[model samples]
Target: MNKPVPPPRLRMALIGCGQIADAHLQEAAKVDSVEVVAVCDMHMDLAKQAAARFRVPGIYDNLDRMLAEAKPDVVHITTPAHTHGPLTMKALAAGCHVYVEKPFTLDAIEAETVIAAAESAEKKLCIGHDQLFDPTWLDCRSRIAAGQIGHVRHIESTLGYPISGQFGAVVAGDPRHWVRQLPGGLFQNTISHPLYRILDLLPDLHPRVEARWDRTKYDFPTELWVQLRGAEITGSLTFSSSVYAQRVTRVYGDQGMLEVDFDAQTIRRHTAPKLPGAFGRLEMPFRQWREGARNLQRNLWRFLKCEIHYFSGMRNLMAEFYRSIQQDTEQPITNAEMLRVTRIMDEIFADCRSREERVEEFVPETRELEVVR
Candidate 1:
């Protein structure tokens, strides 16, 4: 008789038990190829609680000890930004694939180090830029690529939120301890997603930091305006954490434009004329009226209920990770792409620090035109 085949060996560990760790746990539970064998956190109690909550067999306050004993196939690093680089290197050295949270490191050099370690260890490294996996983003990208919008000329991406004092207070209370330590504030913490997504859609694009400004008086910069120059296109990115609550992206091409309101699960397309002529510049009366009505309805609907149409792209993100592992292929959001994004962010932060500007400078000025009486 043939010898019994041993069970497939694929164990995993969670390196941080913070709020986002729950998102990791929820996604990991849905994947069948791996088992969560252990969890580790700087706080022993947090580790134990997470292990119990996830029904894992091992728990430790020390990451090194956990790695040595658990010998997990993958280690998810949801720790603070400062710890991400070191924790990732340690896990990679121990022969474990790493899934680090967004803004992989505090700076580009540190991010490069993590990338180098992963390359040397011959293990996979993925960053959590989940917005790239959103259904609306995917659809928009597909349409743009298929020439539905023709040659891409430019793009505009914006994200913001409003809660000044309360927001700072919440960040201060978090003992995970690194948010306060990081050099850049909301720009690094929040806006990195849109900055990266815009690049992902236009891979050949090389953005030059034409201008950097800020306006908020927080400990770190809260807004950024970046201009990117590609081989044949130019784009602008505006990111902030100051608006009451708004997140929207628009991509423009020679033929048309695609607008995505991910928070509202709506996609709007404005197609240009197929042939240029005197009538080409004329706006179709019915189309204009329809668009105005649709915009009003969407705003009113979203105002009534905050969570009505928000599309959580968690499922797609998980699927991509699993597929990357199975196919042994580079993911859409590869380590290289992540490093590029980090580098751009690092440059922005450096520019802001060197210039010593206030956050309000980065905030974009919009005409306060009334949409409703």
Candidate 2:
């Protein structure tokens, strides 16, 4: 066979012009080989707004119309969770590589269907779980691989959002918010961020899980906790809209505990507790002060060097997706991994429903048993 030549640049089209689409567009702007040929939304106002802001050449209120006209090499799906499956399938059938936002689909069956379509179309599919592309997470994973933290036993990922914060307040004001209608409620929109990172370190085929979803202050169940049990390792995801805003993950290994702050882009390790209480207490403030200074220096340096960008991980992921399409390489996030995350979510939602009044609403448990293709 003759060697394939990579295209000069990939024409890109984006669907859904909501808050997240701006992040996608900003990131795409940072990448060199992807061109924003068009923008699509059910609302013409949204489409026109995005086009005006992003300098996109084409604007359409319908996806099929844009796909047919733009003939984009890549379709960035930024639609709601429920629409991901159909849109992804449509793009894949159009022979366009797909970059979809997280919560790949409402359920695992839909995820499998999208995966199969991509395979049949001979195109690449990338999910929007950009946290794995984060420099802090990668550094932490590398340390774990080097056994800097010893044998991994458990991980706890905590994501806190102030419900009254800018976006949350808006969602709270509307009773008909898209997030409130999700099968997993608030979790459906946010849980995937941490679960994908957790699943990366703890990949269990038949993992056991325990979960809880409840509302203490918020009108809806804004708090969620899901624990996954593997034979060798266990992981937990705690997402709360009421807590003070923070994103951090803790890795409990035999040698020590590794703490990673995603927003701060800092990783701190705690070795086996050897220091005496009084001395450790005396040294703690200095240690924290030094660490803070170091983090500030690192972040400032990265920003000065143009190494830092908002939603940088998302940008890195989009760039990698384009590279995979051009070079015929493996996807940045594999379909199997995407399916597993959806399956895990399925189990949690099912379990939560069975406990609450929402039982019988979740898809059957059989979907969680999907095999890797």
Candidate 3:
């Protein structure tokens, strides 16, 4: 009998050559079935640098030229948030599956249009909500599915950004940066990370949203607080630039709680102690030590396997996306999920604007005034 045939390799190309593009390229290299055929960027120097680092043969300063010349089967759009919608539509039109980096689009309307284009083109579309695929998050989901946490009651997602970080500094220095032009300003560029967590755990697709925006700690409004309520669960999201960089999500269930720390790549499960009163208090430290030991062992194993890097989640997501395209299976992230998150973000920003306007109206003197020397 003849052996079964293997599927042909896939040709992948990247459209943006920014810092995030390196993560995409490095992760793509781990997928055995895909090849980095080309890279394109508005800045030719950035494109050339990426090609040289990844050993990609084709590089171009124009998307049309790269699409025509490289003939890639998949294109990864890691450009700024504003360009996501148009670039995705163009890639789908060019007969290529697309993986768009997040803040999927500026608004839900654009998200709907781009997704429709991908559907019309009959190609797979994936978003860069890779945090959901992180090892810690994966373990948390598995534990929840196994009834370790019972029914979830509430979720809190927090993302802290340091204003001194590379990207943050860029935005701070350039008054006209693309992020500043976003409706939600800097928050629009990052809130998606924390927001996606709540949307995934909450059953409601259209949750009621309330938001407050403030800039007490920075020249621009770099802090956001959002509250969302679904049918059975309530969630809150926090994005702060004043705080030290941290990424954490906590899910509280009837029986216990699960906390995932993205910055440390660890998860901790909490539950009521068997002992009562003072005994329970005494047992808490021991329980924490056990949890820490478990996390250490798990991370050590992953480290030995060379999977302890920052972009491990991206690698998993990219592999799944490529496999979906190869086998004609559903994409890892549903179009509905993408649209729901976008819509919620839109509602949050709208509320934030209204609140800001009310604040300005109530306290006219509080508004910034030009100081004369």
Candidate 4:
């Protein structure tokens, strides 16, 4: 087979010199058709530090200055969630396609505004919902598409993170952290990952959200359950602070089930055997063992091939975003998907906050009625 021709080189600039900027730069370096021309941060020293570290050609403390000078074909927004909408608008206005990190904005309205700006500017806006493009994640979708897993009846996505992780530690230490300012608190910052995974399988663009925050268990909410009711498929997202830190999504299909574990980077399928119940039960363990062995072998091969990167999904996502630019094709992650995820998040935040207010109001009324009695 003939190797495909390479796309023309495109200039790229990165904003936000936070922890996530490193990930973006690492992935950008892997994309052969793109050059990291500039790095920007609100602080010049930080911007200079990142520019030096990545060997980027230019550094700027202002978005407009960088955009005018770098004249990049694409801009990567790695800033905080609160800053996403404005940064996206700035980039799109500057005539550069934007690749923004997830939790598109603080609310759906903000998301809609940015989408409109991107559309008006005739540019593509791709969010960093990178998990959906993962190798195991893609394999699961392919199985469902090929009818190997039958029809997907439902999906369950779970994110179990530690309350004492490096980032969480910063938030825990100070109420003034930007994450705490989010309407849904830390949940808002992280829930987009698993929720998008479930949303990708559902047919409906809009889903009914029923969520409850469990804060009484501790000083702050450490567990949350969001029930999503879609047209044909129902899904749930569970975010909890637990001792076991793991990430997994299970797709419940009619013929069988598939589980994608992000932490282990493994995909396993479970199916009913054609034999009798007892024999099927006996064979199931062997089937599982075989799958485990297969995954191990695949990982070994990938490691030896040097195709294993900690953030391979992030790398692949950038590659496709650039491909869209090169081919003059549709975005890898469509603008519609970005809006849907944000809308769902907006619904969740509103529901949670409204319920908390209702509870407080009811408590005062109940106390008054008790005194009257």
Candidate 5:
């Protein structure tokens, strides 16, 4: 007997029709299991344009109206930082799973509120710290677990880029707006990725941060230094927006080191010496390794076919949200982790406000990393 096939698509609603929203639309279109049924934006014109481009039937200037009309199973919020929590709460209350843009909310309190709302509603709430969804991150986790570099002792990650402020200005479309008012800032946007990544990789670590910013000396501080603690490792992250685009992460251990360029899709490892050398030095030979660019290019091509790898990590996250909701299971990236990241952000901001000149040492309570089943 022939069996009936389940429907391939799940209905989706987009709550913001901005630049990031377009990336969502493009990616959602490629996933055979999802359909964008409607779009809403504060700007009606932008919503209309997005709907037309995505071929969604419904468009609205109001989120409530859109939700009432579309009744989508998934609601994606790509709104500005401040509006994320409110919109997510509203969506969850309406019995819809949510995928929110980065930073989740402006502060930890807002994140807690939304998380509680999602729990009460029994709907899934996922943040868009997409870097965790990257395959490179997955591979990194696997290697770390296998002790490929022994015990991870320190980590250094950085992201920087040349800026005209044109992209942000266009998105905000208001010269005096806060998003536009701050040019080349890491706190508001860029640091979210590295912070989230660290939390994801080192789940047991609670980071305490001390940061300094000088607006007169540099555009938007342009640099952030963070020290993190874990049961088995202690790490530091330096993020800067002033230099040309450079993204790299180095994981060091007692035995050796592993370096990854996420953007470049490359990984290199240095092994410990198996034998002693003349000067009592272990003489661990340095070896260069690369994940052929062609392989990375091919994976990227496959990823782009569905707009998967775009926007840092949203596509993979949306898939996980769907699975979590359907299976009624806890997601790998949880509200607890998000809250921890928020706390770290808060510490950084508070430290910046104090104008502290030196890094403050913090001893974190160590909890061992449980092996993933």
Candidate 6:
């Protein structure tokens, strides 16, 4: 009997050779079903550097030329948030499947427009919600599905961003940075990571939003609190630049609770104590210690197997997306979920702006009284 031949790999071209671009390329390289043929950036130097580093054959300063000459089957847009809408539409129009990085677009309207274009083009579209596919998160989802945590009632997702860090410093230093142009500014660029996790659990897209935006650590608003109320599930989000960097999501359920730490790639499950009364209360600390040890062992095992890394989620998401296109199946992320996340962000930002205006109005009157005194 003759062995079967494998299908050809999908040709990929990456646009926007910025800080995030390298991540996309690095992860995609691990997916055997895809090959990056070209890289493009407005700055010729950036494009050249990326091509040389990745050993890609085609390099172009213009997107139109790259799309025409490279003739790639897929396009990865790792550009700034503002250009996502237009660039995605262009790629879809060129008849290429798109894997665009999040904040899918500036707002829900732009998201809808780009999604509609992808539909019209009949190409698969995916957002860079890689954390949703991380190994630890996958394990959490499995336990939830197995009813370990029954009937999820609430979720709290918090993200810590250090303004003095590499990317944050760039945005904080330049007032004219593209990120500053976004509606929600830094929050718009990042909160999508935590926001989508909540949307995945919500029963419906329409959620009542309440938010507070305050600037405590920087001139720009660096602290945000958003509460989302769904039909049965409620969620709260915290994004702080002043705190120590961390990414954690706590899920509350009727039967038990689960806390997932993205940075440590660990999860802890809490349930009713085994013993009765005071003994049970005392036993809780032991259970916590055991869980921590288990997490450490799991991480160590993964490390030994060469399965642990920060971009593991991105690698898995890329492979799934490639397989979906090759097998002609549904993409891992639904357009509805993407739109829902964007719409929630829109509401939160709008509410924050209204609150800021009210504060501005009150502040001037106080200043006038001080001048008279």
Please tell me which model should have the higher lDDT, number 1 or number 3: 3
Q: Write down the lDDT that model 6 would get.
A: 0.92
Residues 1-373, model 4: lDDT tens digits? 9998776788999999999999999889998878999999999998988988889989999999999988998999999889999999999988999999877888888998999999999998889999888887887788788887798889999998778898877877787889888877888899999999999898688778998777733466667889999877999988988747878999998999999998788889998886788999889998999999989998888889997777888988888988888888999998888888888888887888788778988898899999999
After TM-score superposition, the amount by which residue 152's alpha carbon in candidate 4 deviates from its true location, in angstroms, is 0.2
Write the residue-wise lDDT of candidate 6 on 1-373 in tens digits.
9888777999999999999999998888899999999999999999999999999999999999999999999999999999999999999999999999998999999999999999888999999999999999899888889899899999999999989899999999999988888999999999998888877777666889999899975778999999999999999999998899999998899999999999999999999898999999889999999999999999999999998889888999999999999999999998888888888999999999999999998998999999999
Candidate 3's residue-wise lDDT over 1-373, tens digit each? 9998878879999999999999999989988878999999999999999999999999999999999999999999999999999999899999999999999999999999998888888999999999988888988999999999899999999998988899999998888999999988998889888999888899797889999988864678888999999999999999888889999999999999999999888889899998999999988888989989999999899889988889888888998998899999999999999999999999999999999899879775554443321
Report, for every candidate in turn, its global Cα lDDT versus the true structure.
Answer: 0.75, 0.87, 0.92, 0.87, 0.71, 0.92
Q: How do the residues 296-362 of candidate 2 rate in per-residue lDDT, one tens digit apiece?
A: 8888888899876658789888888898888889999998888988998999988877766554344
Displacement of the residue 204 alpha carbon in candidate 1, Å: 3.6
Per-model TM against the reference: 0.80, 0.90, 0.96, 0.94, 0.82, 0.97
| Top candidate by TM-score | 6
Residue 148 local lDDT, model 4: 77
lDDT measured at residue 74 in model 6 versus the true structure, 0 to 100: 97
How do the residues 10-34 of candidate 5 rate in per-residue lDDT, one tens digit apiece? 7899998988899889877766678
Error of 6 at 158 (Å): 0.6
* Candidate 3: count of backbone clashes, pairs at least 3 residues apart or interchain: 0
Off by over 4 Å in 3: 1-3, 365-373
Ranking by lDDT: 6, 3, 4, 2, 1, 5
Please give, for residues 1-373, the per-residue lDDT of candidate 1 as tens digits: 9997644646879999987888787767766666889999989899888888888898999888998999898899988777888989999998988888887888888988888888887889878888777766777888887897798888888876553556545764563445656766656677677777678766662467654756665544456787877777766788656665667888988888889887766678888554457566565554556766876786676568652323246556756675676567776567778888887777777777766644444433322333332
Would you list the clashing residue pairs of candidate 2?
none
lDDT assessment of candidate 2: 0.87
Model 5 CA deviation exceeding 4 Å by range: 1-4, 165-175, 180-186, 216-219, 272-286, 289-312, 356-373
How many pairs in model 1 have backbone atoms within 3 A of each other, for residues 3 or more apart or on separate chains, i.e. clashes? 9
